[model samples]
Target: NKQGRRQSTISLSTGSGEPISLSMPASGERRLAFMDLLLKHHINGGELSEEDIREEVDTFMFEGHDTTAMAMSWIIYLLGHNMEVQDRLALEVDSLFDDLHSEMRNESNSSSTTEITLDAIKQLKYLDCVVKEGLRLCPSVPLIGRSATEDMTISGHVVPAGTVIYCFIYQLHRDPEIFPDPEVFNPDRFLPENSGGRHPFAFVPFSAGPRNCIGQKFALAELKIVLARLIRHYRFVSLDQP
Candidate 1:
């Protein structure tokens, strides 16, 4: 009734007359919690129910934390095995600092504060390639669930409507034709020259098309920041090295 989209009923009933725990306190602390926001919206005649609120909150917490943790762990492990790559990344980060300080030295004629800002971090082209390669090798979500909306033929196989499909990202990433020496940890593989003329779907760590991960950009940026900081200070060594 509010907008074009149908809103869930605020009246706490699970359709089967079963009691659902969606207790909203009258007044409490500041607007910090999800439940607080839900209560506010409900009071304002917004139609999202307790289950809706809970499900949304759970998705946010679970998906955000778990996936990011997995990606970071994999990136760290990959870096450990590839000291040369880590060293190169660190050098690039240092060069950025040097460039910044040089510009400041010319501007104010004194040493400047060398801090990595979001804008500056985004400019790290080599680092960007490294992270992309890492993601291609070990996507946090190794598989994505999708269903066909219409009948289609893929690789000569007719896929009927309503057919549930699981795209194996990990296996696809290792396709020898698309990625030669697929098991190798080569950041250069993601370089512009190498990536050019390649199939777009060949390297879809964040999935592809309209249903691709909504948090891909945020997650990649977070990964870059963390990896940049870590590489700058510590030289991670492989424990398996004899």
Candidate 2:
């Protein structure tokens, strides 16, 4: 707890109140609150080592902001180009709850009690498809680079140990065989019937395997909430100047 407060104080002082003026969410506060709870319950007697806490906090901020911002920009661009898909998405958003008044009441009730559930999100299949397809088209990070720990052979090509390998997610996603008319912005491609037979790695906007993103659920939830609210309020139209 002291360490967290110290870090926040240092950040504030070093920036001459610029960081505080930015008024970003106090991630420092969240960490401190969690640590306080742990101490109160005797779950953790000692503080997290400074290095460990800093690394974890850095990782969280990088992944949280970068990935979601990129995904949102791509989704909005996709919607701008594909009016039909955007219209369908707007309709789905509109039909999700009974009406605006009912939805407001439900939101208030839900806020007071339980957090939004995965089940509620699952019901909005169309919105999900839009997000998934947008991710496929413009993955936030286009390529994933990894180094081989040991020598490996694939398709008669031997990769020497310590060789750096680049997996081109963007190219893989646009492969004609995997995605018919790959250039088109068609969210229906993510529909169960269409996506079922595809190789799992064929559509890895969040990547695959154990190291895959841990915040995929959080990102999806944020997208759904934002899209639902935006579509219900004002319609989007591309500016002529652009």
Q: Tens digit of lDDT per residue, candidate 2, span 83-197? A: 7888888888667654544666677865232223456557789988998889888998789988899999989999999999999999999999989999988899989998898
Instruction: Give all candidates' CA lDDT scores.
Output: 0.79, 0.71
Write one digit per residue (lDDT tens) for candidate 1, span 1-242.
22332333444444498755444444543343675577667656757666677566656765767788888888788889988888898999988878987998899998788777788898898899888888889988888888899999999999999999999999999999988999998889888998999989988888899978788888888888888778777888879876
Measured with C-alpha atoms, the lDDT of residue 123 in candidate 1 is 83
Question: In candidate 2, which residue ranges exceed 4 Å CA deviation?
Answer: 1-31, 34-51, 99-118, 240-242
Model 1 segments more than 4 A misplaced: 1-35, 42-46, 105-112, 155-157
Give model 1's clash tally.
Answer: 0
Against the hidden true structure, what lDDT does model 1 obtain?
Answer: 0.79
Each prediction's Cα RMSD? 6.7, 6.5
